[model samples]
Target chain A: MKIVVCMKPVPSSEARINIASDGRSIDPTDVEMVANPYDEYAVEEALRIKEARGEGEVIVLTVAAEAARSEIRKCLAMGVDRGVIVQDPALLGGDGIGTARVLAAVIRELEPELVLCGKLSIDVESDVVGIALAEYLDWPHVSLATKIEWPDGKMAKVQREIEGGAEIVEVSLPAVVTAEKGLNEPRYASLKGIMAAKRKPIEAVTPSVDAGQVGAAGAGVEIVAMNPPPARGGGKKFEGEIEEVVPQVVELLKSEAKIL
Target chain B: MAGRVLVFAEQRDGQCRKSVFEALGLAAQLGDEVHALLVGDAVASQAAELGAHGAQTVHTVEDERLARYWNEGYAAALAAAIDTVQPDLVLLIATVMGKDLLARVAARRNLAALTDCITLTENEGTFEAVKSMYGGKIFATIRAKRTPAIASLRPSAYPVPERQEAQPTVQALAVDLPAEQRARVVEVRKKEEGQIDVQEAEVIVSGGRGIKDPKNFEMIAGLAQVFGAAVGASRAAVDAGWIDHSHQVGQTGKTVSPKLYVAVGISGAIQHLAGMRTSQCILAINKDPDAPIFSIADYGIVGDLFKVVPALVAEVKKVQA
Candidate 1:
């Protein structure tokens, strides 16, 4: 079995976001970038699957700036066999679909039996690329997968989280599955794994798609502006006797908030 | 003006979900003529409800392959509907299934789609959508650059329009399923009966590390029952095994925007705040006055949650009486 894990480096959750002077994107300076938390689950699941099979390969595929190679190395350090990063200046403004197009092109060459990615990136929060890549590959996709089992090496039994519970799905091989929280606790890179990762092969290539289909020029949507969230007003805090303040808070909920 | 807008009405158990009406409401507001697309087994029966919720036309594609959500099947059905309707804009509610289906449909057609939009406005024949990004630290306004622009509205972000007596024209769309299908839903296990998902709830009562023990979640659940709210928990509570991960609200969990969000004992990490800061009204109860939750809360009470939560629940009952 060959499994590909799609990963991206996103601004850490703790980093403060600032709109760029261009007013359309975030300022990259001073931002601490890390592997998207959800993708770590994807990498972990891929490694676990390979280890279980004992005769399979695990690869990490990413489409990001050249600077994100370190993030890819972080994944390799976690026991992935190798990595691939698609680097192109044109991809800087690529929307989710554009990124999916690039990824699909690379995935076609690899022809892995399964593909995995985070359900949604914490940075863009669009939740597009994984399913879109599945579409481009013309394969079945199960999103929000909390558990997955390969029964007999040709079928995937997945437990996907839904609104109020879960659904047990059976998808054939050559499918895409997005990792959700609770899938597994991702393991940290051990000293031995880290040492092995330093020598792992990572190749950077540009996507061979139409010039009109993989960049800001090919973007179907454009971010016209970026700004801070609207600040809340009339935010009042009361500290003192709980007996006195609880009633006052209830009064406000009734009259002011109108939600009572 | 965008002439025709189409909404993919999501259905479960042969019934249209609340999000279908919410998407229709926004579609009616944004498009000159609003159409709804329903794909599932025996879904035509719900077309009337779609009509009531401002759909000028309802398109139903009935097939067993779509009885449960398989992305390829749903995307093919939606693509067929789009080919037939040729609408300027397509809308779907940002539910778990809806998000999965939208991305595939948009990608298959090579169109631009904005997911989880809080608000939308018509721009010429295209659309501009506002959505929170970077875990609610920033807001981005996105503009679609082409026709048939696809977008998914966040659940509960828009009001369901008033029902009208006028009947909408019902069109039955033919499903052109692809020959190769590799996935099928074998079984769906529903959680506790009558439990409301935090994202769909109008009111939410959330707890955090301050609640102390797993047993104390009962207090949170009790307070939630009084207001008929869903139970939510911060990451700390979930990590401590005090609550299920499904109830967690944070950067890694579900992002919600309920009508009223009551944070009890939650100190509000930035990640937790990101999941809920967009809520309409926020109330926080904590012993620490400087808890970050207070910064965004519309109202706050500094005290012990055990003392304040039960009291607040009683006061709410009294007010209702």
Candidate 2:
């Protein structure tokens, strides 16, 4: 029961986003990068599955730069067996398809029985790489999974969130599942685990990818410009007794907002 | 490059969704020929309505294997439609199903796809789009270098065109499906009827940490009921188990941009604001005058939500009556 969890470091949710002078990328200065919030659930779910089985290995895989080693180490501190970081400048800022191709190549070498990833990264919010990776590997993918169980390690029963409710899905082994929020409460790294993580092996390797087929060069989509959304103006506050203010709000809703 | 566009007109339970028409409306503007592809068990009859909405050609892939959305089967169907239509652009409404299918098909063909775009424009057969990043904190205008680039337009971002009498050629596309599906849906559990999805609602009334108790959501629901709007909750309320995640609106939950969004007791964390700052009109009702929610709100009421919500509901009912 080998499981691989895919995670990425993204700008923290609380960080203010400022477009760089290039007008195509965010300003990275003064921004804290952390594991994508959803990826924490992916890591936690993998750990739970491994603990339940009691005789298998879990690996954390990431295609990030050198700065992401700390985030990968955080996953190891939470009890993953080891980590693999694909350090390649060509892989950075590639479109989802290109990134998925790189991940699929690495996943083929590992040959894990199951692969898990967060539903989407907080930075790009594409929600494409995981599903695309599964497609590239020719495996079944269940996105937005809230619950998963594989009693016999052959067939997996997953519960995924849909628009209105839930869908119960079943896929064979060697499948990909994207963890949604509420899948599990991720555990913080203990002092002992942090000490253990430092000794755990982290294999850094550059993938054998075509130089012309990655990064911004090989990306099919080109970003033309980046800008902040228009500022929201007019903060008309009405403060008074509820009886007097309620009508005023309704009057404006009908007349000014014209939304009624 | 051909000035033809293909849109995946997503349908559920034998009826087409309004969001598909919105995609079609945008498609009509971008391409000289607009083709609608509807895939389901028996959805050919709906092609007439899609034609009325502005599709010059309606492509239907009716198969029992596609009764439910099997990603592989639907992707194959879409790929076959793309092969036959030979359009320069592909558009879909960015629903959960749409986003999923688009990724799978794009990966299969190694095509370029942009998802959840808010705006799209064309220049000499090249299509460029603007999409949000970091949950709408910044906007990026992008262009795909490949022909027949795919993009999923966010629902409610484009308008649904008015119905007109037009006849479109209905073509039946044939697709090859795998003998055995790798994944299958065993069951679907849907929420109770009359509960609108916040993404589709025109008006939304949201509650946050200030609501205090789960039962207090009834007041929020009351105001929503008065105007037949959907009820939304902030991450704080959802995290506290006050509501289901489906009703949540924030960076972690669903992002929405309805016509009118009313926040009650929500202090407007940066994440919450990221999800809703693009809304057309916003109204915030919070006890704190300095709440971040007020900064983006068009109308603010500085008072306790417990008192303001009920009175506001009563006044709305009176005004509508």
Candidate 3:
């Protein structure tokens, strides 16, 4: 079995984000980048499937700038057999649809049996790419998968998380499943895996599609302005007596805000 | 009218979400006829409710396969619905299922789609949607140029209007689900315990790594019980195994905006803020004065949660008594 996991490089959850002067995007300078947290689940699920089968390959693929090479290397260290980096100057500022188009092209070339991705990237939180890729590839897609089982070569059963409960779905082979956290615990890189990852193949490919063809231009949605939310003002400390503070706060909500 | 507003009434187990009614309230202001599309088995029962909530017409599609959502089936049905309606604007609740299915529909139709919108207003012929990015640190007003401008409104951002006493026209639409497109739904496994779903709760009390230990959540739950609120956890708490992912609120987990949101021992991260920032009244309790959650909270208590939460719960219970 050949399993391909699509991942994106995003700022580490710990990093502080500063909006650019334009107020449209984040400032990437000095921000430590890492694989999207949800993608980690996808990678770990792929690894688990490969281990269960005892014979398969897991390839990690990403579309990022040259600065993302080190992050891609981190995925290699995590036990992926190889990496594919789709780099292009025009790829910057591309929306979800643009990114999906590029990924579809890459998937066409690789033709993997199973595709996995994070349910949504933390950076955009759009969660569009996986479903979009499935549509472009004309393949069945499942989102928010918590558990997966391959009953046979042609069929895969997956447990999908819904609003109130989880539904078990059965789809044909050659499908896409977007993984969320808690799907599996991602393993840490072993000493042996880290050393071997240094020799893993990392290939770079340029998208053959143009910006206009893939609908990269003319973002229907444009960010008009952005600003930090207002700060919470100081509040009186009600440490001495509960009786004193309770009525005080209630009176404030009723008289000052008239909400009560 | 230049643009017709379309609302996707999201339903689970035959009940429509509050966000659906909220979307209709916004659509009523657009001066366009609001048409709602309901998909599921025996969903016609909901058409009257949708009509009372400002939808001029409710399109009902009854399919047992659609009762349990599969992205492909939902997307295909929605795409077909859109083709039939050809509306100028499309709106959905920014729930997990809506966001997942809308992406596929937008991609297939080559239309622009925006998610997590807190507000929507029209300018000229264009509809501008205000969305929070980088969690809630940055707010952006976005305008979609494409026809049938697509957006998913965050829950609780817009209030649900009182139902009007009007009998709306109900249309039953037939959607052909291709044999190859049918994905079998075998079973529905609910969370073992009957814990309230954080996303559907009207009130939520969440904790983070600041709580320090898993056992400390008892105090958090105590406060939540006073208000009949659901318990939530930040990514930090979930990552530390203090709670399950179903209780997690953030970009990766569930996005919820309840009427009242109380954060205990949570130092708000940007990702965490994105999930619940749109909540109506926010209260933050923490020992650290510098916790980011205080930034957006309407009420802040700078003290240990152990003392603050229990005291607050006691006061609430006394008031109720």
Candidate 4:
């Protein structure tokens, strides 16, 4: 079995995101970037599959800029066998199609039987690339999988998290699945794994697909403007007995919110 | 002339979900032709209902292959729907399933697709949608450059149309799905009996770490019971294993916009606030006056939840009686 883990770097959760003066993009300098937290789960799942199977190559794949090489190397440190980066500068901010177009090409080259990704990039929160890639490959795909079992070479049994319920889906091999949290606890890089990763090769490859078919020309959606969320007015607070505040709340609900 | 708007009718177990009607309302608001595409084994029963909610035409693709959600099957049919309609705008309800299928369809067509939009408005033949980014810290309004611009509305963020007894013309659309499917849902496990879906609930009563014990959630449950509301939990409570993940409402959990959200004992973090801030009314109950939740709440009470929650439940019951 072979596996490819797709990941993107996002600003560390603690880093404050500042909109650049250009008003169209984040000021990349102000924030420290890390592998997306969700992607850690994907990387870990790939490593675990290798451990369980006892023999396979796990490759870290990404469609990002030159800066992302270090991020991919971190996954390599976590015990992946190899790293592949699709380093076309133009692919930056490629809409889902643009991303799928690039990723699908590299995936075809790697020819991994399974591809895993974080459920969504924490930065853009688009949640599209993995499914779009699956579409391009015409493979079975599911998002938010809590549990998965590969019963045979051709199919994997998966329980996907849907609102109000869980859906158990059976997907054929060469399928795509995005990792939601709770899928697994990602392993920290061991001293041995880290040193081994330094010597391991990081391969740089560009998507051979036609750019016009993918990210070019905005891929359909345009970011017309960027702005911060409107500040909400400070609300009323009552410091007293629940008895005192209850009636006031009911009154306000009836008058202001109009739900009562 | 604004071009035709199209919505994909989302259904499960033969019942049309609320988001479809909301999508239809958006379609009606945006364009002259408000058409919807419905696919399933026997979904025609719900066509009249879609018609009542502003869909001028119901495009039905009834087939057994689509009875259960197979991503490829749904995507193929939806891509065909787009081709036939050649709509200027395409809308889908922002549900877990809707998000999964819409992106694939958009990708197959190489169309731009946006998800989790909270609000939208049209001007000069272009529609701009606003949604929070970075765990709700920032808001961005965006548009798609391509015709048949695709997007999904956050659940309950948009209004569903009022029921008017009107019949929409139902037309049959033929779509052929490939024989060998890549993925197919084989089983569905519903949440245990009588528990409401938090995002779909009109009323939500949530608890936080302050509940102190797993058993203490009963007080919060009592309040929810009083109002026939769903029970929700903060990330702290869930991370501590006091409640199930299904009950969690936050950035890492589920986003909900109930009509009335009663948040008890949660010291609101940005993650927790992002999920429920879109709710119509928020009532925050916490002992600390300085708790962050109070800032966004419509009403707040600074007191021990043990003393307050029972009393408030009784008060609500009294008013109802």
Interface RMSD of each: 1.3, 1.1, 2.9, 1.8
Tell me the tens digit of each residue's lDDT in model 4 across B33-87. 9999898998999999999998888999888988988778888788888899889
Candidate 3 residue pairs in backbone clash: none
Ranking by lDDT: 1, 2, 4, 3
Give stretches of model 3 more than 4 Å off: A239-260, B192-194, B269-278, B288-297, B302-304
Poorly placed runs, candidate 1 (over 4 Å): none
Considering the two chains of model 2, state its CAPRI-style docking category. Answer: medium
Error of 3 at A7 (Å): 1.2
Clashing residue pairs, backbone N/CA/C < 3 A, model 1: none
DockQ of each: 0.80, 0.80, 0.53, 0.66
TM-score of decoy 1: 0.97
Q: Taking the candidates one at a time, how many backbone clashes does each contain?
A: 0, 0, 0, 1
lDDT of 3 by residue, B34-126 (tens): 889998888889988999999998888787778877567677778887888888778898887888878888888877777878788888877
Superior candidate under lDDT, 2 versus 3: 2
Model 3: how far residue B289 lies from native, Å = 4.8
The 10 consecutive residues of candidate 1 chain A with the worst lDDT sum are: A226-235
How much does each candidate deviate from the true structure in C-alpha RMSD?
1.5, 1.3, 2.7, 2.2
True-vs-predicted CA distance for residue B294, candidate 1, Å: 1.2
Residue A237 lDDT in candidate 1: 93
Q: For residues A1-260, could you state the per-residue lDDT of candidate 3 as single tens digits? A: 89899999987766667878888678888988888888899999999898888989998988888877787788788889999988776765566766887888898899898999998887766658888888888888888888898887468898887766788889786888899677999888888888989999999987677677354363555566666654444344443354455556545444553434
Worst 10 residues of 2 chain A by lDDT: A205-214
